[model samples]
Target: MNASVLAHRSMLAKGASGAACLSFQLNEQTPAIFPMRQVQEVIVLPAQQITPIPNMPSCVLGLTTRRSRVMWLVDLAHMLLSQPLPSNIRNYNVVIIRVAQILQQQNMLVATAHKHVLLGLIVPTMKGVVRFSPDLIQTPKGHFAPGLAPCLRGCVLQQDEMLLVLDAEAIARSPILQSI
Candidate 1:
């Protein structure tokens, strides 16, 4: 769907607590959310649409076109949890995130630059958008799976579900994805 994240963000700013987010699942047991501002779109892509590349990270599921623009698709579970999607799956629930971030780099001197990257994360299940107060987001202690530590922004207990807030910029700038 074509979501206007800026619109959602503004609508959620009733005070200082709420933020609009696009929610999905990494697997059956792990639910997660991405700040709507950083998400570009969500789609269900057929398995035949992706053309797999050779000798890349296992998480890298190769490339596909989104609105005629080519972008890489990754298996979010495999990339973060060391678990791949079931082989029998026919379509992928993909969340496309676009991150525009300032990155610091050093050579003989330190400098900053802006990068815009788009990546499609294929999750096992794609839930609709949700809004929760930012105050409810908790720090990610060592309670989560070890592989999930780096990319986690925090966790939120929404009702009875533990929704993981992920770092979109971190995932966009991942060394694995950057190793092209």
Candidate 2:
């Protein structure tokens, strides 16, 4: 992980940056865009009862079933930034991703059903992917939701609009994750 971060930082230093268009919603508005490609698959998580962790935080929704395995379900918005989650999410997708390089370096077991490292977010839709450059992203400024400040990675400028980018790792490591 350390080497990867260093490599990413070095790449950024050498004018290397990429973006992934993540489709998210905050009510009736269209899916909000987020950039930083790492999403693998959009899956429908089972509606099984979750065993809540005692003394966990509010944003953490708890563990749920996905492909016969128990995976943590987290509040994407609250974890990323303080952006509120959609009021009604009939169903959400569990984005399964893996850091193969990191796993190899750390000697971590190649991700499998029994021993897996995954992060699941409750999203309204699976927005198509969009790619962008690092210089194209802008940092947020001025008054906004307090919780959102830390988790925001950057903002992507598309055509004539801006989309908030999120740090998946930050969200995964949030206090909210304690509940999952």
Candidate 3:
């Protein structure tokens, strides 16, 4: 195996099986991370790829197709902070993630099987994978912004910065996303 891959494996095996996460910027000001295992892939596409859907929540950027499956593209910044991305931005790096089956509600009417539903979260910049020792993850003390609290799994301090670790499953099963 390559040196980088070997290093990643070693990190994953460390500290009671530490969690590996993909760190990204929600906006210029907000930094966050999501479990790497939840992400299927990351794609860079032009703004034109997103077809705007009218009457949808502002957080829902619209729909796009990948590997013949329709995926809902959501604005993570807007969802978390009510701040839409700048209109001048013309491209996005999207993280494609599978919503964990446990997040699906029994009564919800879903067009596709719960396991197949994929969400594309739009992030302006990706900071790469970071591994955190399980011991370093702290249970949130209800100190996060109200909008983001529900979707956050916890927070961890890395290099003096607190990175909110988002719960991808919770985000996928969010009422707002389900209503779409």
lDDT by residue for model 2 over 1-180, one digit each (tens)? 256544554554354555445555632442355443556566775445544566556556667765676666666555545555564555555565432222343666443335435766766556556555555556765555666666677665454445676666555555555444
Name every residue pair that clashes in candidate 1. Answer: 17-134
Let me know the TM-score candidate 2 reaches against the reference structure.
0.62
Worst 10 residues of 1 by lDDT: 1-10
Weakest lDDT window of 10 consecutive positions for candidate 3: 7-16
TM for every model, in the order presented, reads: 0.81, 0.62, 0.81
lDDT of 3 at 80: 80
Cα lDDT of model 1 by residue, 35-126, tens digit: 89888888899999998999989999999887777889999899889899987888999889886644455534332335556789999988
Clashes of each: 1, 4, 0
Query: Ten-residue segment with the worst summed lDDT in candidate 2?
Result: 96-105
lDDT of 3 at 155: 77
Q: Regarding lDDT, does 2 or 3 come out ahead?
A: 3
* CA RMSD of each candidate after superposition: 7.0, 9.0, 6.4
Sequence-dependent TM-score of model 1: 0.81
Question: In candidate 3, which residue pairs get closer than 3 Å at backbone N, Cα or C atoms, i.e. clash?
Answer: none
